[model samples]
Target chain A: MKGQIKNTLKGLMVDFLFWLYLFGCLYYLLHNNWGWTVRNKFILITAMFFTGLFFLIGDSLGRKSFLPTASTNRKWSHSVWGWLLVIVLIVTFLVGWNIVEVNPYKFFTKFRNAGGITSGIFDPSIVGYQLSNQSLEELKLDGVDQEILEKLSGIIGKRYNTRKVCRDDLKRILDEEEFRIYGEILLSKTEKNMTMLNQALTALAETIFLALLATIFAIPFAFILSFFAARNLMPHTFLGNSVYIIIRTIATIFRSIEAIVWAIIFSVWVGIGPFAGMLALMIHSIAALTKLYSEQIENIDHGPVEAIKATGASTIQTWIFAVIPQIISPYLAFTIYRWDINVRMATIVGFVGGGGIGLLLMQQQQLLRWHNVGLIIWLIAAVVWTMDMISAKVRTKLTSM
Target chain B: MSYLLEIRELHKIYEGGTHALKGIDLNVRKGEFLILLGLSGSGKSTLLRCINRLIETSSGEIIFDGKNVLQMKGRNLRYIRRQIGMIFQQFNLIKNLSTLTNVLTGKLGYVNTIHSLGFRRCRSDVAAAEKNLERVGLLEFRMKKTRNLSGGQQQRVAIARALMQNPRLILADEPVASLDPATADSVMRYLGELNKKDNITVVCSLHFLSLARKYGSRVVALKDGEIVFDGLPSEINEQKFKDIYGEEAEEVEIR
Candidate 1:
């Protein structure tokens, strides 16, 4: 009789907690203005009712008892351990979604806006704007309207300056699709676009060079630090082990901070340009390469190390003859791979005044110059693709050697 | 009464509590080729390693050339290591290095490590490396990497490397364990020749009783980390063999 009473009280406690938690969550959602309104109250209650039923059924399944007595298929309730966890996840997901107030309509709008912007960026306007009077005569021969041709010549005579024509004047002249001939004429009248394109190309060169310089500069420091950081080399003695831990900890802390954050600090240090970008990349690569190279050291065959030591070689002698030969090939391979990674990151580092194609891209994007942005994007893609191919080939060659 | 190496009550309890060597006490004469006979885990490897201080002993006294090897640190330890050469079952030559370079590395104890890194060994160093390689009959293959050599040839290259040390003592830890019958004999022959020709003290461990009988000037048998028999190869009678091997073992397998 006592055991039966205790069982009843335990079941009652579990059921009470489950129901209370369910109701409390619903009340909190309503109180927080998520669904307490008259129109959404019905939807909210319906959702709550379904969830409540799911948990109630799961709880009954957990206890192996039901309102009417579940039948032959009730064997599933024997494994009630997994049910509570599933219900908890479902409840948390629903409550969290409600808390965040995710709207499908708003998500769809964002998707649509992103699609429109992507389309605009891909549609590069390559029409030249600097047409001579002789080109206007040629336009006339192509059956362009006489008045539009005259307006076109006026644009060319002004050396394609937007300042020469009012905003409304230029827009009106190029407004109609039929007068796209004149639009082409206006396109042929802009010299400024060509200069912007030239600048983007030059900035792109700087970005590539910056990444190269960073990786190159990082190699010497990273190479030296790797030997100290290697657990096998340094952890043999207490002092060496402490040095290993210290170097490893510092490298990890630096690795956690992204290259851009480093770039920001370096831009302040060296004054914004490719040099600052190179410096930031170099520092980040040092931390990254130290970790990678030391792991390489740890994985090398210890047989040669022992063999060298048995020859009665000194500490540095063991490293020079045994350790150095094993690592040189892998070191070259990793450096090439790092150089490839740096090139891709170099573009973004430019946004913080670290001077690269990315800086011009930031400006062009903000100014809504989709044509210039398109040009920069294509150029960067080309450079990165080339680098990827070259680095892969070089890495294979180096490692294989 | 005279000995080149003296070991007293050596104990090696590994970190995880494996008593690999339990109070080993032995002595090695200056020019004797001593064979250590034991089953697997009989502390041959541990005892050999402790002499070189490759694995630190738990407690012991290992006196080599009147200097206590157990108490050595830094340069003193290295100096002693230079006098005693060691070869493993794996041959342990840097695989990517040429046969000559592998042999040249044996002289690393004498040259500055930084200076050695330049790949430009002095004329005498080169001549010595060549001489050692020739001694092992691998002079023709000096330019080839050790990885390209056969198991027997690689072992010989390793022997040549040990010779570069002009080692006063050579510790061979199951050097022929990995080789087939004929190849094992050839490798053992090189060690035997080195022992007789140079009068270098040799402490070798071997699993096969036949190799022990053929090569050992004196044999020390270990059973469960303690010396069971210290005598000549001819003295190991059938009953004695049973005590050393711990079972009724056939002479056929002993080969």
Candidate 2:
């Protein structure tokens, strides 16, 4: 009889909480979207009246056994609560539509704003002007003026040079100086393309290595932290439980923030470059891999642990022999998966001055050099594809073995 | 008779309020193959684990080899545990590791932390592991992963692992409960041999009466956390079996 009363009280508390939450959401929606303020006493009173009436009706029906019994094969859609659910869903969708200000016509209307970039991408500037290897002294003797010589000095010779000739200078150098163009333009375009390709390849290599270093750096930290975070491995004592919670909470917080956000903060701290990018990725990967590795630890077979402990193995020995053996395959699989994600994240980190092909791509994009942007994009896609294939193959092999 | 193990007023109450062991007292003599027979959840496993301090008893006195194991902590407890090896029904060998590594893990109690960290077993330890494996008839399969071995083979590997401890007492917790009838007999034969040859005090739990009678020197039957019968294996008649197992229980033949 005491248990019955306690159960009834618990059910009443749950019902009250359910009604409070439902009304709370309704009030938020009505006040924000329909201008129904708290001062609107009449509407508020009517809502309260309906809520009370509904509960009273339900209570009375339940007491009198008027509601459909569990044995009855009632169709859920035909129920009153079902209709209310459908109404709530439709109202939420309508509010979402208004909030986002959905307008499909603007897509077609505003598309031409992207016309210049689209055309530039369509005619990718693959060909570049190959600068002559003729010495500055030779150019001066060839009757080239000192000003033109200085301008040409910035664009030529250094295969890894970042500077490119401006439009006006390029036209002047190519058109007005008939002597230079007739001798240079035909053969130099391929050489110029080669230089661009070479730059792309170098940036690609930097991006991959940056990702590799970040994954490698994160592994040891994550591996050690995972033992603390794993619920099964941790003791049920107060200190152990607290440590588990602290590690889990920290990991969750780190993982919640995107790698791009970390990159932005790190780029500021470390003053930009692949190092900052690697640092950002490493932090994110440590948190992500900790969560993965700990979960694998939790799912390990308890029997081996029990057996090991029974053999009078010390904590460290038990971990090495029993726990580590079971987790190695899954840990390797998670590490490879994290490395794959880090590679993709490395390219994006560059957008925030974290440094890689993304930095080069961002610069080209801002300068309206869409063709160079297109080239960087192509290289990124190819590398990502190859990485995807390799990770997939390795993961399958690890799991199968 | 020298008592190898002594249990007095051992009571275990789980967090879920399960009165699994309710005030038990028993004494085990040296060189005795004591077979524990009981229904599932009758505290057979609870008693075995308590001997090695595997499961912390709520309130009890467990004296193993003249030392009060309940009061022992850290190194002392490990020392006591190493002298008492345990086997399980599931044959809990590390499946991903080779049979040799699994056997070597049994010697973890004696190994220093540095050697364990590097997973470097001494040459003598490796030789002992091989000898133990050969004793279990698994020396040829030492390089194979335990997962690739058959169920019976896996249990033999578990035995080899236990041998690495050089235990004076072997606790078999329903070791052959998962094996076939023939395999179960073969596994018990190995334990019987060890009991006879090495004079190891074994406290094994089992559901099968046939295996118990054949291998056990004495049979101890428990009913609802209290011993109902303690005598020679030949003394467990039909009436005694019913008293321990309850009215509706019928003895099922393994063969």
lDDT of each: 0.81, 0.83
What share of the reference contacts survives in each candidate? 0.71, 0.82
Model 1 CA lDDT for position A339: 88
User: After TM-score superposition, what is the CA distance of residue B56 in candidate 1 from its true location, in Å?
Assistant: 1.0
Per-residue error (Å), model 2, residue A398: 1.2
DockQ of 1: 0.69
Instruction: Looking at model 2 chain B, report the run of 10 residues with the lowest lDDT sum.
Output: B112-121
The alpha-carbon deviation from the true structure for residue A76 of candidate 2, after best TM-score superposition, in angstroms, is 8.2
Candidate 2 stretches with Cα past 4 Å from truth are A1-88, A115-192
Best by TM-score: 2
TM-score of 1: 0.81
lDDT of 2 at A329: 89
Candidate 2 chain A lDDT trough over 10 residues, lowest sum: A60-69
TM-score of 2: 0.84
Clashing pairs in 1: A128-A187, A128-A188, A129-A187, A129-A188, A129-A189, A129-A190, A130-A188, A130-A189
